[model samples]
Target: MTSSEPTSTRRRLRRLWLPLAIGLVQVAGSYGAYRGQLERREPDALMVVLALIGPIALYWLRQRPVLVLTATTISTLTFMLLQYPYGPVILSFVISVFSAVIAGHRLAGWVAAAALYFGHVLGRIALGINEDGIYQSLAVGAWFVVMVIVAELVRNGRERSAAVARTRKQEELRRAGEERLRIAQELHDVVAHHISLINVQAGVALHLVDRQPEQAGTALAAIKEASKEALVELRSIVGVLRQSDESAPRQPVPGLERLEHLLSRTSGAGLEVYKTSAGLPHALPTSVDRAAFRIIQESLTNVVRHSGATKVGVHLQYGGTFFELWVDDDGNGVPETVVEGNGLVGMRERATALGGTMTTTRSPSGGFRVTAHFPLSAEDERDPD
Candidate 1:
């Protein structure tokens, strides 16, 4: 076993030692008290035997409370029958009560306590003991009541502590979930956007190589720059998933301001593209910016892969309540046979995580369109950036 395992086991053993020691000590002390009674010449052999048995049995009371308690009852009754003072054996009664509480049988414990109390009172009465003295009986009843109250209070305090620990654990889980979502958003933004641009630029370089060799070389150089930048950003974003000593990159991440460069790369790819925006460029939540960027990039990717049409359109509009994004391809719309893939599922998760919505639908003019509606305010509150 590992060193940690032994240390943990040792800790557990240490916790049990004190309680076990207390029980054994109490039993030994009771046995000594009984022997003292025997030396004083008031020795009832039955009382001595009963006293010895009661304390010894109490040591195992928690593990076998019912059996130990049965012994306790028999021993205490034997003492009383032989006309012995019950005061010296009172510790055995308290121990029995403690055992019952630990066993989660409070009613049985109380019943045992009551029986002990009444047995003493009734026996004393029968033996012509003073009936005017009820103080002793009252004292016995009070002691039992106090033990039960203390046991119940201890049980409740432990329950409250457990509830607090559970709440703290749930709060920790919620914070972790939020952190994962923030990282996912950053990955979709930084990696996907730059990768889409690189892919487009690479395609442009390939198409122009034969007709315009010099121009093809310029496109190739741009492609190299875009790919290298994309790889660096991708590595940085992926690093968030690692459990390492290094810190996350604190570089200023791209937002709407970088959209122009992103779109320029696509245009350089020789794809006809148009972009229109209505609102003044405003700072958006990192999640919203990431989501908006992803939706546009994925839509363009779908256009490149599936659509035969030459033109694509991207529209961004920000209102007081929400920010709207629309990407449309004037190509053959998505086929009914097209199965939803991980990319689509990822897009949906991103939208839902931000408390936003996205939909893919066929446009009226025989084209495919993607619409993403994001609640900018709701997202900004939790945006890590």
Candidate 2:
């Protein structure tokens, strides 16, 4: 048998054992009680049948709680009225009350318990067998109250457990959504930046292959380098999906430390690039550092793809509370009706996700400019040196 087969068999046996055990207990206990009672009527066929009715009804209590409770209550009251010796015959009735209450049938369970108690008392009085005093009645009432309290507590505990399960499911879904967004951002940054460079170099190689065949080698080489870098970054991003036992790519995550390599790649695309920095440089939070790098990388990619500018400038500002990134190119400025594309949207999302802000507008040099500001935590502002 498969693993699940044994578990299923165990569950079936678990479900059956309760009623079976209760039936045996009632049959044996009632026979013993009958032997001890000399004043009550002697054991008869109908008495044995009545004692078995409640336990039989209990077998269906989980599936049909209200119906089973009714059946057990009637059988129990009839047994009491007939003056059968008191014993474990009422066990099924008690189980049914708890089952009904826990099945969200509180009103029915309460009424049934009250009816059994009052019915026993009233039935005894009507038959002129009211020998038990008020103290006995009060004691029975206290036990009934205790039973109801315990059932309510079990019901409350089950409800709380279900609520906790629902909250955990929602939290897992939320984390899954965030992870998807992060992967999308990473793929976009990796593909867009490198592919833009490769595209430019490919065009240059084709244009010079016939007239300036000697210079075509340089363009072809740039294309090869760009494609190699793209593959490395893609592997790094895709490594997150690997199984725990599998080896992952050991590439370091891109950050401001890789700014020179990014600038060189952009310069290779035939753009004259200048870089400048202000304020003291310090180690940044990994998230802020990565976001800043992506914003600048995407901005440079947009310049190469859209702006025909031969020159671009990148500026970094490190402050006590914030890190800033700016990229401007001296190409045709953005048209008034130009719509933002995925590259720009991804950059904005990265900045905002890190509690930062980004803006895209036409620069004073008559070209498009992208600027982003990322906040720094106290730890990020600390000097590592």
Candidate 3:
């Protein structure tokens, strides 16, 4: 058998032991308590059956709380009406009432407690059993009220704990979803940018192989460099999924600090890229820096793959409160009916995730232009030097 079978059996036994023990206590304790009250009715077969039935019904309390409460209440009231000596015979009834309340059956628990208390008092009055006075009846009423209040308090605590657990689970699920989206964006940026360069250089190499074999060698070298960079980036992104004991990739993440390297790689693909900066340059928040780099990278990739232009201009404007990035190409712009693809959507998501805004439009030079603005916090304005 599987290991779970034994564990399941143990759990069942643990659940059963409590009610069984209480049943035994009810039977034995009532009989013992009855001996001290010689003036009351002597214990008989009916009393023994009544005491045993209440605790037996308790075994199903968790599954059918209201039914168990009803059964135990009837048995206990019958025992009281018979003028049997007062004892621990009511223990099963008390346990069932508390279980009903804690299990979210407040109405059933309250009604059952009221019926038992009033039934005992009225039954004694109807039978002309005046041995106990009104003070005893009032005292029993007060005790029942206390029991209900205590049960209500315990139920409230359990409900609050359950709500907190549900909220925590939802928060964890939300964070996991966001992390997956980030990884997807990273993979898309790395694969799309490098693959576009490789495709362009391969075409150039094929075109010059027989005509200018020396020019073909340059194209082949560019292909090798692009592929090597792609592999390094792919390894770094995939390393996040590896086991904790495994060594993580030590490659630095690409940010605006590596913009010159990115521009050089683009130029190798036979595109004339011009970069310009305005205003004072300062440090940026890590998130904003990475987002700025990826946005520019994706924009350049789009130009190489779709635009037939030979000249492209990249500009960075560092302002006091907002950092601006613009990429313009002297190529045929996108058609108005063209739908946004994954590359464009991923770029927008990256920008928006860092409280940045991006826009794409036709430039004055009859080419496509992408512009983005990222707001800077006070800490980002400080110079690293």
Give the candidate number with the greatest TM-score.
3
lDDT-wise, the better of 1 and 2 is 2
Which regions in candidate 1 have their CA more than 4 angstroms from the true location?
A: 1-132, 174-212, 243-245, 248-250, 336-338, 376-385
TM-score of each: 0.72, 0.92, 0.93
How many residue pairs clash in each candidate at the backbone level?
0, 0, 0
| TM-score computed on alpha carbons, candidate 2 | 0.92
lDDT tens readout by residue for model 1, 1-385 = 9999999898767656644554455445545655555533244555556667777676566678777676777677656656554345656656666767755777777677777767767876787766436786797679768887786676667768889999999999999898887676556555655565567667777787888878888777777877776777777767766755487665546556666766766666557888998886566777678677776776776676667657888899877667888888789887766687655666777788778888888876678888888876644544536
lDDT of 2 at 220: 94
Misplaced by over 4 Å in model 2 are: 1-14, 382-385
Question: Cα lDDT of all candidates, in order?
Answer: 0.69, 0.88, 0.90
> On TM-score, who's better, 1 or 3?
3
lDDT of 3 by residue, 63-89 (tens): 899999999999999998998889999
Q: Which residue window of length 10 is worst by lDDT in model 3?
A: 241-250
Q: Any runs in candidate 3 off by more than 4 Å, and if so which?
A: 1-11, 243-245, 382-385
lDDT of 2 at 231: 93
Best by lDDT: 3
Q: Model 1: C-alpha RMSD to truth? A: 5.1
As for TM-score, the candidate ahead, 1 or 2, is 2
Task: Report how far residue 12 has shifted in candidate 1, in Å.
Answer: 9.4
